[model samples]
Target: MDFSALNKSAANSFNQQKSLIKKVLAGKKVKCNNCNTLISVHTGADSVMIKCEKDCTDIKLDAELLK
Candidate 1:
């Protein structure tokens, strides 16, 4: 019956993730753990992806993080 708590929790989660994304973007040391190469960030219509150029790692996140 109480949605306020749920909404606040969700908002907090989103904010945390967004902050992480910003850090990743601003960091120059971001690299693929598997291959030790630089990772690439790509944004699409509904999603964002962080991938290694050598195909060693791939991460997909919600596009809302970029907003």
Candidate 2:
């Protein structure tokens, strides 16, 4: 195995996670619908997936429905 390559891959993964965390911190947040758990949100994203509490169900939110 190429240790250097593995380290580089890990570093890249770390950077991506760090960036996502920073983005989450900088973005808006709302409570999870079912559990009321606070979750970060990225409104402008294309939204591949938005989940709360790792591996848990995703909460769907609609402004109209909230009203």
Best by lDDT: 1
Name the TM-score of candidate 1: 0.55
lDDT of each: 0.71, 0.52
Candidate 1 Cα RMSD (Å) = 7.2
Clashes of each: 0, 0
What are the models' TM-scores? 0.55, 0.30
Candidate 2 residues 1-67, lDDT tens each? Answer: 9999999987876765455444454565644545766655434333333456642434333434323
Error of 2 at 2 (Å): 11
- Cα lDDT, model 1, residue 24: 69
lDDT of 2: 0.52
